[model samples]
Target: MREEDDKMNEHALNPSRMRGRRNVFCWFYSKCLDAAIEKKWKHWNCAKCEQRHNRQAEPEISLQVNHNIAYYEVSVKY
Candidate 1:
């Protein structure tokens, strides 16, 4: 009871510290997909470090789409 309640509170607070982590990855993945579908190069900066990178010739375009689908599936499952 009380211990379970404390654990729940800890879990709730943990994500606030991890805010924007998932969004950054999702945004980057989507930008890469869009670049591939449009046949153009896209650039992205790291959310944490601001390092620039380009999506010029990714070999796993299909894998990115599959990953996005899997993420959605997991969200729905939970």
Candidate 2:
């Protein structure tokens, strides 16, 4: 039982959070937004990055949006 708890703890997180950041960062949120749309998911969350995105709340609002910012964010971050 303890081992199970430990495993869950390893991947657990608050309903909303940012992995290494105190706040939700833009790029990760944007990417997660894209993924949620692609997969037709209402929401998407990445435990590793601790980014949770809601497709409807993001700019993937059924319009052509520039991903340049997200790209730049990734390049600068990485």
Candidate 3:
């Protein structure tokens, strides 16, 4: 009985055991945003060096639309 209690305490104290759900949601959100960005722009160059040139200039509405599409795709898949 003591061993079982100790095991339960160890499991309860372990921080690594508590973060799986949050990590999965964060990963999905990142993937959805990345897909939206890729789909909206064509040049796909580094923003820091490229200075927004050679890219398909889109309005904010278009970006929001693409983001919604990508978010729904991710949500439906998983």
Candidate 4:
């Protein structure tokens, strides 16, 4: 029981070393507006999205790509 607890604690402390280390996924969201008319457009699954999907299954790993900026957001729900 103590060993199990220690393992769990280690995992919680070092998530990057946890089992099944996977690549991190990233996507970009952009907005464009028209000068003449007031309108907003949303583009889903852009090149970045597709690339992220093709990377890997694990989330702890990192991918190599050339891009301007990358951002990640977390979500939690009960």
Model 3, TM vs. native: 0.19
Which segments of model 3 are wrong by more than 4 Å? Answer: 1-26, 41-78
* Each prediction's number of clashing residue pairs: 0, 0, 0, 4
Q: What is the lDDT of candidate 3?
A: 0.32
What does candidate 1's lDDT look like per residue over 1-78, in tens digits?
A: 465346434542111212233233332444434443465434332344221232433455465444535544334554
User: Which 10-residue window of candidate 1 scores lowest in summed lDDT?
Assistant: 12-21
Model 1, total clashes: 0
| lDDT computed for candidate 1 | 0.36
Compute each candidate's TM-score over C-alphas.
0.19, 0.28, 0.19, 0.16
Which scores higher on lDDT, 2 or 3?
A: 2
Query: Between which residue pairs do clashes occur in model 2?
Result: none
Candidate 2 per-residue lDDT over residues 1-78, each given as its tens digit: 465346335653333233232224433354445555676765444654433332223453456546655443334554
What are the lDDT scores of the predictions, listed in order? Answer: 0.36, 0.43, 0.32, 0.30
lDDT of 3 by residue, 1-78 (tens): 465346434542122211122222221233323543656633232222212132222333543444535544334554
User: Higher lDDT: candidate 2 or 4?
Assistant: 2
Which one is best on TM-score? 2
What does each candidate score in C-alpha RMSD? 18.1, 15.4, 21.6, 22.0
Candidate 4, 7-30: lDDT as tens digits: 434532221212332223321111
